[model samples]
Target: MKIRCIAIDDEPWALTLIEKYVKQLPQLELVATFEDAIAGSEFLRKYPVDLLFLDINMPDMNGITLASSLINKPFIVFTTAYKKFAYEGFELEAIDYLLKPFDLDRFQKAVDKVEKAMLAAKLSQKSNDASIFVWSEHQQVKVILSEIMFIESRKDYTCFHLYNKPKLLTLLPLKKTEELLPSQEFVRVHRSYIVPVKEIRKIASRKVVLQSGEELPIGRLYADNVSALVKL
Candidate 1:
């Protein structure tokens, strides 16, 4: 499994050490490193990572405080020189707490725990019923797997096109909504559109024709993602 990660520390040397250790493990992909806790927190807000290696004491905002405030929380491993903060880390449900000057072996153990937790979470999601619920027309509307034809992002909201129902205009981001659907059933062919794999009727050089005769342009960057649509 590929684990995307980021290391945040006030100390330059600490960040370097963790970066080196992360690189030693081929499974870990270091997205970015930060010396400022506030900047690191902002990065997490925009981009989601599988794991985070955080230092406790820092200027502006502390590690524990920053971790708690994150809306999309990643599996965090606290790295700090102070042992007194271990209990606080536990309260935040951190995967592991590593003391300063720890070796690569200790880092490996923490990463191992992250991998196992991620696997278990994936399995749990797969075993559950596959469906997406959205608030539309002032009510929570449950959309089944087969009812959806396609999804379009409209600035601040997402529009769900259905077979026999009116299009659902809900307050949702395309990226977040994509995460809620089964990957095999949905294909995101553009930044603004996600088509149900089964609904695709034909694919051209730059666009796709749906079974309902809807044509959506394929994004330049996301073109490769729609190759599976060709087979179906």
Candidate 2:
């Protein structure tokens, strides 16, 4: 699959160079380019891409601040002239840091890393879409993995909330249910709640909102899990 990408750099030459390098790779698609970080941030809010080529020293808002504020972050490659920002860039889990005057070979290396990461994510998601059997109503029930929205825990039972279907209440505990689901697809946001990562629409103010408009509280202990969700 082609990885959709966008470049944001205050320097026109930097943006042009990134565009040229992106065009050289068949696996990468350049969707847009911006010389203003604010304008690029707006575009990202409306359009989600797989990867980003970002310069760190733009005016008004630098790349580090912009990257940290994104709710849905893309794989980032920080392209800048300054070497001092390398630690900060990697701390944000950037795919690569390309110093100024980088050649096509260096750009290709960063793209290679992005491509590998994307492939791995796709494979993990595929594995999460497999069906599993659950005991409900004294019988074995077949549940489609992809249809699950979230799993809620009751005092002595676990509820499997599916899309457009009745929830299944089993005698199983939430901990046992968590063990059965794929770790990559399901996350425990609270002691009593486990939500599918893909089903999460937004996370704000210690609350996890699902795509269905259902909001669940993010437990104090699980707050870090919610933070990690955005990075995923």
Candidate 3:
């Protein structure tokens, strides 16, 4: 994974060192460097990056203050000569703290932590995408995508049929319900019915036979798409 990063330091030599170190790593993509903290903050507002190499001591603005003001904060790695700011940096949940005049080995260790954190974040997002939350019975309920067998329209409400569980009824129109489901996993076979693609056993005589042995009629408008599943 290419990690887009930027460095902000008032010292030109520090920025040069950061750029040189970033270029040595194949996974690191240094997008931009800033010598002014205020200009760096403005750039961050317009374009969010994955990582930030920030200097704590700047004449214009304090690095910690700028980090706190950001609405979408990136993973921060604070670089400074002073050790007093280490506690404050950790309080902001900085990935790592690098002392100034540090060698390449220390910088590589900080980047390793960032990579692990990014990988964990991606895995968590994938897990969240495999489920959905809906208001049911006056409380939000999590519906696992894999457990869904079919969906049936009931006027202004929709009923979810799941595997080995009681049916769930939610106050949503069929069109709204369809928008929440993944298209590749579920299909609208009729005006009143939506079935999981994997649960479909066969299609015959304009009827879809599910793996559970229940059959649903295919609507005239949706017959072409429903029949196409047989070709798969």
Candidate 4:
């Protein structure tokens, strides 16, 4: 199923970039583009959308205020230059908050998060629930997709942190751990880590901070992804 999205940004170049990215992704259909939040609101009210690529710093109406005014909300993915609003976006229940100047690959990664969530939601609705067969203490444990956060790797052993209770630890290398996790949502952006794309807070030059306020070093090998992400 395609994700119908509408791009809204005050800047012409930013809107154009979003348009270009939308055209390239087969799963994303561009329903419309609006320079102001007012026009976008009218379009959205008349026609429902699956996703919205929103700009936070619009002149007339901020993305946050626009989102708050609506009773019905589609999946929101915020785009902004400032990192200060990252926490607020997440608190507002945005699916993903992407910083400005993002590249195609990073954009793809963001879309991947949305797709994964949608797929999981559909599965839940159909009784075809999503499950992950994970290695746990010399045994395999089945985990619900919604129960996970991130895996903390410890030399040849990895601990899977779930939503409740103590985390599950298993014998697995970082590379092996990376391979086992879902590629769309889980990424090895650091050497000793695999993080959920939706869990990220912001990316500075050398490190990425999680929404939980924990910091992880941006590895040399992963620098390209970081660079590409910031460029977007």
Best by TM-score: 2
lDDT for each candidate structure: 0.90, 0.92, 0.91, 0.81
Residue-wise C-alpha lDDT for candidate 1, range 1-232, written one tens digit per residue: 6899999999999999998898799999999999999999999999999999999999899999999999989999999999999999989999999999899999999999999999988865664446778887789989876778899999989999888988889887899889988887789999999988878898987999999999999999988888765655
- lDDT tens digits, residues 119-190, model 2? 888886876668888899899998788899899998988999999999899988898888988887889999
Please, what is the TM-score per model?
A: 0.56, 0.59, 0.59, 0.55
**What is the model-wide C-alpha lDDT for candidate 4?**
0.81
User: Model 3: how far is 3 from its true place, Å?
Assistant: 0.5
Native-referenced Cα lDDT, model 2: 0.92
Report clashes for each candidate as comma-separated counts.
0, 0, 0, 5
Residue ranges of candidate 1 with Cα displaced over 4 Å: 130-232
- Residue pairs with clashing backbones, model 3: none
- Candidate numbers, best lDDT first, in rank order: 2, 3, 1, 4
lDDT computed for candidate 1: 0.90
What digit string (tens of lDDT, one per residue) describes model 3 on residues 1-232? Answer: 7999999999999999999999899999999999999999999999999999999989879899989898999999999988999999999999999999878999999999999999988865774469878878999999987788889998878999999999999997888888998786789999999998878998889889899999999999999778677677
lDDT of 4 by residue, 1-232 (tens): 7899998888889899999998899999999999999899878888988899888988889999888777778889999999898888888889998898999988998899899888887855643245668777678888665566666788777877777758878776777767766665666777777777667789876888877777888888988766665565
Worst 10 residues of 1 by lDDT: 123-132
